[model samples]
Target: MQSIAIVLMGIVGMLIGWFVYSKFIANHIFKLDENFETPAHELNDGKDFVPTNKVVLWGHHFTSVAGAAPIVGPAIAVYWGWVPAVLWVVFGTILFAGVHDMGALWASARHKGKSMGALSESVIGKRSRALFMIVVFLVLLMVNAVFGVVIANSFVSQPDAVFPAWTAIAVALIIGQLIKRNFKLIPLCFIGILVLYASVFAGSYIPVALPETLFGLADTANWIIILFIYAAIASLLPVWMLLQPRDFINGMQLLVGLLLLYGAVFFSLPDITAPAFNSQTATETPSIIPLLFVTIACGAVSGFHGIVSSGTSSKQLNKETDARFVGYLGAVGEGSLALITIIAVSGVTLAASPEEWHAVYSHLGAGSVDAFIKGGANLIANGWGLPVEFASTILAVMVVLFAGTTMDSGVRLQRYIIQEWGDIYNLNVLKKGAVATLVAVGSCLLLAFGAGGSSGSGGMIIWPLFGSTNQILASLTLLVISVMLIKLKRPAIYTLVPMVFVLVMAFFAGVIKLKEYWLADNYLLVFLDAVVLIVSVLVMLEAAAVIKRFRRGD
Candidate 1:
């Protein structure tokens, strides 16, 4: 009965989110002008800003938002309990994420495809724009760093998964090129992707030893080096060659993988294994609330989505009205993905005896996540009549591909942010692509310092901080959406409700983190927590100020 309720709640929530509430938000609040020429119409150049078919645009938008973070965050947050985690996915998506994403598209389209920072200045104050840009840049850095670690860890732990993963990407690139060049090779490309997926599973069984060059410095460190090298090359590559093609291919893989996962969970009808509610663990859990909000903030509501939604997607939008479909629908799809992963994790871990579960729970290292995902994959394979190990390997490949897409997108977005900062600062060095690349690379490098694999290490301690950062970013995102809705002289309730919800949750989380740090004896987490608290508070205050300004006709 409870499972039925959850399933029903999720379905209804998604329905309201997509067809009813989201449409209301779009029509009444956004007032998206159909006549207003979008970048696709106004700035079309047969490339990034060219108008595309709705399905193709949807693919682009969905791929941009889908990534490894959605998988990791939900996988970890289920530790809290399936109840809160599921609710977070449901309510958070409908009330906060769906609206925020649609609003971003509407606002950016209104501004002729100006990026979020530019939209911020037009909607909020000019000063707030700079702050928004900086915050966004930092968030992107953290995303790149963490995702980098995510991919590297997968490669190191499941070396056999690498060939199939890279092969899938190679296949995607070929398809993208054939489509671009030949125009009639789409069917062939699709066939190739299917073949490549099967081959990746086959390749996973033929394992080979990883070679170490600089004294036996552990396979993990070697993975990191290899990852950094890939990031460097991918960053330098054009979008058409590696990045875009890989995204298209992996995006399809992600969709199929998610569908299969959900089908497995649903058809198998696994019982929830975790406690329904565990407030005790919820409070002092390894996560700093603020940090967890930042870390897990991606699935529920993310500022990053706004950037992708507005930045690249606006150019390809067939209609201003379609923003709701691409942005809001995409967000809900992601939240659903998160919910599925969380339920799977909670079910598997809870299936074990309480004492055994507690032992694993207490010392849940990074390997624990890999194990959980593998276990879930195996369960699906067992029920579906497939090889368990092969299923697990394919799952690992999908995860790595997800991370790769995220890293490339992060770097590209960060590059643009750097260029924008350059324009704002009036620095001559910023004008040169080489200099902009340097600044962007430096930002990525700094973030890479903390990109240790997600093993609940000290780096994992930063997870909560990432969550906090994302919440703060979401607060800012909400402010932009609300103000833009107001500027269009639309009803503010759609924006107002979500704006208030995100602020309250984010503020509560931040305050909790600050209090914990103040009471703790350790200076490091104390300082880290303190820093997060201050930034969060200031950002919230700024968001409040913007909301007030919007309300007062300022």
Candidate 2:
């Protein structure tokens, strides 16, 4: 079948999700009230809480939650076949991700923009809150550290992307100031795009490369340190100063990139080179049942989205009703990216034939972000007549910028978690923004350098556990939302159904990884995996007890 068919299917599915399902959810299930003052107004401190336009907030939420996972996960999961990967992205987005993301945002906005972990205390119990926060902190650490490495590696490998990558920051700073002065958004958006693409064009001509070693560390390691430092500073800044504008611009860039990719599909009309289901499998490949769900977390449903929804987005929501737009549509935007990634890697753009595609995906974790870049560039070059080098540079910069935004939000969220901890225990030290920022960055740095030595690749060591761990967190977030719905005396079957399915699959995936870690003698992953399982089970038990008590009127 033609790859356009797959594209059409995904587009139609997501449209239905947005226009029909999301409206029903907003009106009935979530019951978002436009008059309800959000935390951004209720707790407006001009630092963390500032009322934001829905469109701008959507951009921040979308780009922050996207990162590289949607690309990387679906890119790799095509090993199972394009059918499973595409279906998961489309249906998962409509049924799972939309509700999860939107619900988290609504829940948080209702609770004064508290993070999901902190909000758990009100809905579930105090014990559940601490357990929930632990999972959240671990997830943030993994995200920030790994994304620092991801951006650093992208800079080194694709030097052309480096100039445009950093140029974006300057554009965002200017845009932020202008927006604060009540500048018109449409014009600023156009100018930002023009400047950004001009940088991309210029970058292709004047590539920037760093030395092999800097400050007695390898270039990648040095880049990692620099990235974390930048993230720390970015996180410390007010949302309007950097995070909001930067992410908004990056989100616009991604929209243009997606249009180019989808245009390539229409013009070139490439054939699906991958099989719907793989009869021939690698010996090392895990079963497709649960693994596929965990693998394609972001494009479908992700726990990380909950973090961003509750962490930063909720704090800036202009109106409670905007949750559907900022959260659910933000999820649809990611699903679109993931869909294009699947086509880029699975269609003739990547491999000329099914056999060639199979060879490229010979192993379980064979295809990745590199494959997406190469394939997407080729597709654009073929269809749009752009030079392959220029196309590659655009896509590379897209990946780097996305990952960088995610790192920014991850560090900020981590600091929030730390501050919440201080409030929970009356520890004044952790309550200070600067001190919390230090602890956040310090933990990620220690994990990177201490675990990976001078190479600073330790984040990847724990990355193998991220897929299962992330999905499990998604389940837990859904669980928290479901509990909130029940407590409010509303229909919770929407959240409850998705929560049950995700938890079962994620739990199974964790068990599978635990056995693999034990056999490989990767005790660190084994211990971490076991801890996640235990905490998840305990949280579930706590929720069950609360429900039981509620039913008993106790």
Candidate 3:
């Protein structure tokens, strides 16, 4: 019953956000016009810049931005208590994420589809652009490397998901060709989903696992290398060929998965077993004040959203007016996923009572994606009468697919950033697509293997820094958008308030983590943390200077 109430409240808030608040922002703040020519039309090259339907574009944006962060973040943040996590996700989606994401898409589209880092130059200053790109690259590096580890981890732990996960790619490739040939999307979507689920059913019956070691590397390490190799090829292909269709399919699958999870909550009416505010937190758990904001980043507000909005989604925008649907609603979709995740992890399905709940979540980061999977599977088995094994496979594939899509977009965005640097410095070598992709993929590989050593799990070594760094990027993105709004003479308060709030929280979190890293003698994370903090401060100061000049009409 408590879980049901939470679900109802979250859904209602999101509805109001999408129908009423989003429309208001779209009309007045963004001033979206259907007559405006978007970059997809202006720079239609049949590759990265192809005009796409709002529905398909929304699918891509939602899943790519989602990844496994929302689930993993909320699942872990429950150590602080579900109330704080839920509040941040709901209000943050309405006030912070919706505005920031839509603003980035609009800002980038208005400037011919430049990434936020590149767009910073037009809105702020040249030095801000360089600084923004550095932050952007670091965030991308963290995302690509971390997500590869996440997906590889999933494959190793949930071998049953392997068959359906790879099967999704083949299905997407076929769907992509069909979409390109002018087939009706309605029919293609149905067929693709049917095939995907059929594969899921087959996967449950036949689980696959790699040998203990492949090529003298651990299975997880081999999977990480293989996943990146796949992502590199997928990134270089035409947007219509793999990225768009694959994300669309994954988006639909996630929607179905969410409906099932939410339905189980309502049908079973699970009680909330976790405390509203934890009284027995692990002694090492940091203060929830600043950590909560950064811990549950993607579900609440994330800097990575702006990167995808401006980098990939902006390039595929078919209409300027569609920004509201693709951007705001995408945030809404992810919030809903996060909402259910909180319930799935905290409800009776996970623990019969409060004591059991605390035992399971004895420490920060105790219950992550695995907790969500187990709880969600139990819910499905209880409510829908499905076998837990099959339910587990479905949810596992959901996480893998979402992470896979993010990897695709992350690598491609990294390539775009590298090529932008090439243009800025007059280096023709980096301008080539293949060369840029190598650098993007190569960098992530270096981080993974170089840091993790034999396990290729080095991404996890830097994972703790991701939350604070990602939110800082989000605040910086909001800062860029706020400055743009002010320059246009429109009301900028919407973006400004979120910017100040997120920056302060993320900055504090970074400082806290820096101290912890230093004490632990993790010099690599300490160095990376210092770099992000310094770059963020410099970019903020540069933007402030530009805003001051703009206010003076200089």
For candidate 3, the per-residue lDDT at 540 reads 93
TM-score list, all predictions: 0.87, 0.99, 0.99
lDDT of 2 by residue, 195-287 (tens): 999999999888888799878899999899889889999999999999999999999999999999999989988888888888778987899
Tell me the TM-score of model 1: 0.87
User: Model-by-model lDDT, in order?
Assistant: 0.67, 0.95, 0.93
Cα RMSD to native, each candidate? 3.6, 0.7, 0.8
lDDT of 2 at 203: 97
Clashes of 1: 10
Q: Roughly what TM-score does model 2 have, to 2 decimal places? A: 0.99
List the candidates ranked by lDDT, beginning with the highest. Answer: 2, 3, 1
| Model 3 poorest ten-residue lDDT run | 454-463
Compose the digit string of candidate 1's lDDT tens values, residues 348-428. 523554444444455322223564576568556745766777778767777777777777667667767777777888876
Clashing pairs in 1: 290-468, 291-464, 291-465, 292-464, 293-467, 294-466, 294-467, 294-468, 295-466, 295-467
Judging by lDDT, tell me the better candidate of 2 and 3: 2
Q: What is candidate 3's CA lDDT for residue 220?
A: 95
- What's model 2's overall lDDT? 0.95
